[model samples]
Target chain A: MFITSIGYYIPDGRITNSDITEILVEDNKEHFSKEDIEFLTYSCTRKFEFLGIETRSCCSEENGDHFASMAEKAARKAIDQAGIPPEEIDCLIFSGVTNPFREPSFAIMLAHRLGIKTGDFFDINDTCNGFMKSIDVAGLYLKSEKYRHILVATCESPYDLKNTLKLDIHIENTDQIDNRLSGLIVGTGAAAMILSSDGGKGRITHYGEQRTSNDWDASMLTLPGTAVPGAKYGDTITGFWSDGRLISSSLIREMPEFILRKLSEWGLDAQSIDLFIHHQLGNNVTFALMDKLNADHQKAPVNTFKQFGNMATVNIPVNLAIADEQGLIKKGDSILLLSSSCGLSYALLHIVW
Target chain B: MTFDEFKLMVSDGLGIDDTLLNRDLSFRDDLGIDSLSVINFLVKIEHKFKFKFDVEHIWAMKNLGEIYDTFTEALNNK
Candidate 1:
C-alpha cells in the first residue's frame, strides 16, 4: 500500500523539566523527605537529559483537544493532503494507548466527526505498536482489493499527571519517584497517514515477520482489567507504570537478532535502508538498535524522543511525517520502520519511498 | 583493555570507587547501577573494545565478571 499523505498535530501545551518537577513536588511534598524531594527534582531533570527528552507536548484540557478531536484534526490534514473527500476513505483505523473512550471504538467516533459515514472503523490498542499493526492491517485490506483508500491515525496523551496521580498515594522513597517518572516524561501527539492502492510517493512492500515474546507485564497503563487481580470492574490505577530496565534490556536482547534475521530473510542489509524510522521508546533503545544494525546517525533519525518524548503509537508516524517534511526522505528511497512495544513485540516494515 | 583499566574506566564512568569494582559485584544490586545505566555501560564497553558483544549473552550478566568475559571472548577465540 502506498502512503499518499502524512500529517501530525502537537498540542499547544508544552511541558518542560520544570513543569514535571513542579507536578511531582506539589503532589508528593508531604510524604517525601527533603532529600527525597531533592532527588525527585534532580532525578526528573536528569532522566529527561539521559533519555534525551527535552520538552513534551501536552494537550490543553480547556481547549478540549482530547484524543478524538486531535485525531480528527490530523485526519483532516491527511485527507486534505490526499486531496480526497472524507467519504472516499474506505477505512479508518485509530491506534494508540490514549483513546478517550472504551465503549465505542475511538475510530468510530473519529470517523463520525470527520463526516465519514461509511467504511470500516475500529481502534487498535497494542500500546506503542498500535500504529504499526494498523498499517499492517491496512496493507492487508488494500492488498485484498476490497479497499482503495485507508486512513490510519493515532492521538496519544499519556502525560496527564492529575488523572494519573492517586490523591491518597504518597511518595515514600526515591524508587517510587523513579518508577513514576515515565508517565511524566510522556508527551502528547497525533498523526494521520493516508494509504491508497492506486498512487502515492511511498509503498509498504512487505511487513516483516513479527516476533513476539510475552513480556506483557513489562510496560502497562494499569486499569481495571482481568490482568489486575483485585481490580474491580470500575477500579482504576493512575500513571503509566513500566519496568524501564526490563523493557530496555529485553528489547536490546531481542531486537538485534530479530532485525538481522528479517534483513537476511528479506535479502537486504543495513546499507539498503535509507532511513530506519524507529519506535521512539527512548534515546537508549533507538541508539542501541542503530548501533546493533551498524547504521549511521544519518541513516536513522534519533532525536524524536528528545523533541516529543515518546508519543506512544504516534511515534513512528510523526517521525515519518517530520522526516518527509524536512526533506530527509526522497522518492524511491528504501525505508525500514522498526517498532517494539508493550507486548514486547518486534516488527519491521519495509517501505519504498 | 586490561581488567585494571576496565575497572578504572567503569569506576570513572559510574562514579563509583575502584575498590568496589569486583568481578562478582552485581552492577544492579551491589553497585546500584540501574537498568538504563547498564545499557549505557555496555555501549561504552562496545565502543571501547570496538567489539559487538552478543546480545543474548550480555543480558544474562549479573556482575562485572560475566560482562568482562562476554566482551573479552574475542581474545579467547583468537
Candidate 2:
C-alpha cells in the first residue's frame, strides 16, 4: 500500500521543563527540602538537554480532548489531503502504542465522528512499531484488491494524567531521578495516514519486522483499563515502568543487526536511503544508532524528540510530517521508517517517495 | 519459580546467554547489566515468587547465588 497522504495533530498546550519541575516540587513538598528541590529542578533541566527535548504538547484536558477527538482531527486532514471521502475508505485501523480501552476501538469511534457507517476494523498494539505494523497489514489486504484505501491512525495521550503514573519524589536515592523523570518524557500527539494500492506518489516498497522476546519484560506498563468493567473506581495507570539500561543496551546491540540484515537481504544499501525515520526514544540512543550504522547524521535527522518528545507510535508519522513541513523530505526521496518498542518489537518500512 | 527457572528468566530478560548465567556470576560484572536492571529484575522476581523484598534486603544482594539465597531466606522466614 502506498501512503497517499499524512496528517498530524499535536495539542496546542505546551509543557516546558520548568513547568514539569514546578509540578514535581509543588506536588511533593513534604518529601523534598528546599535544597533538594533546587537539585531536582537542576536535574530536570539536564534531563531536557539529555533527552533532546525542549517542549511537548499536552492535549487540552479542559477542552475535553480524548483519543477519538484527536484521531478524528488527524484522520480528516489525511482524508482531505488524499482527496478521498470517508466512505471510500475500505478499512479503518486504530494502530498505535496506546489504546485507552479494549472495547469501542478507536476505529469505531473515529468512524462515528467521520459519519461513515462501514469498514473492516483492525487494531495492533506492538507499541512503538505499531504504526508500521498497521501499514504492513494494510499492504497485505491491498495485494488482494479487496481493499483499496485503508485509514491507519494513532493518537497517544501518555501525558494525560490518567494514563501515566504520577511522579514520585519520595525516593531518597538521587540516582533514581532519571528513572522518575522518564514518565515526563512522553507527550500527547496524533497522526493519521491514507494508504491505497494506487494512490499517492509515495510507494511502500518493503516492510519487515523482528523481535527478541527473550527479554520482553524489560519494560512494562499496567493500565487500569479505566473503562473496563472489572476495573475498580479510583484506579489509575502505572506507566514508564521500564529498565532503560537493559533496553538501551539491547537496542544498541540489536538495532545494528536489524538494520544490516534488512539492507543486505533486500539488496539495498544504507547510502540509498534519503531519510531515516526512527522511534523517538532519545537523542543519545538515536544518535548512537546513526553513528554505529555509519550513516550520515544529516540524512537521518532527529528533530522531533526535541520538539514533540516521545509520542510513542505516532513518532514516525509525526517525524514524517516535520520532515515534509521543513522541506527535508520531498517527492522522489527514499525514506526508511524504523521502529522499536518496549516489548522488544521492531518493524522497518521502506518508502520510495 | 525454582532457582533454575529464576536464573533462566534473568538470562531471558537481560538478553544474556544461558552459558553466562550461573549462581557464582555477578549480575553486574558478568552480565554487564546496570544497577537499574538489577532493581527491575528484583521487582520481577517478587512478582513471580509472590513475595516482597525489603528495600535494604534487595540492596545488599550481589551475585546470582545471593539472589537465590535471599529468596530462600525469605521462604524460611515465612
Question: Residue A186 lDDT in model 1?
Answer: 79
Residue A97 CA error for candidate 1 (Å)? 0.4
Considering only the true interface residues, what is the Cα RMSD of candidate 2 after superposition? 9.9
Single out the weakest 10-residue window by summed lDDT for candidate 1 chain A: A225-234
Q: Can you give the DockQ of every candidate in the order shown?
A: 0.15, 0.09
Chain A TM-score values, per prediction: 0.92, 0.89
lDDT of 2 by residue, B1-78 (tens): 487876777787667787767888876446656544565556545555656666544534668888888877876776
Regions more than 4 Å wrong, model 2:
A26-28, A32-38, A61-64, A161-172, A224-237, B1-78
Q: Clashes in model 1: which pairs?
A: A332-A353
Candidate 1 displacement at residue A153 in angstroms = 1.0
Q: For candidate 1, what is the DockQ?
A: 0.15
A58-151 in candidate 2: lDDT tens per residue? 8776878877778888889998999998889989888756676678776787877876679887677877777888888899899999999999
Q: Model 1, A1-353: lDDT tens per residue?
A: 89999989988877887877887788788877887777567655655655667788888867877766778889899999999999999899988787767788888988999999988999887778888899999998998999999999999876553364342223556666544655766788899999999788898887864546566566656542325543321234444566776677767767878888888888888878888898886655676677667887678864677767888888888888888888998888899988887767887889999
Off by over 4 Å in 1: A61-64, A160-171, A209-213, A224-227, A230-238, B1-35, B38-78
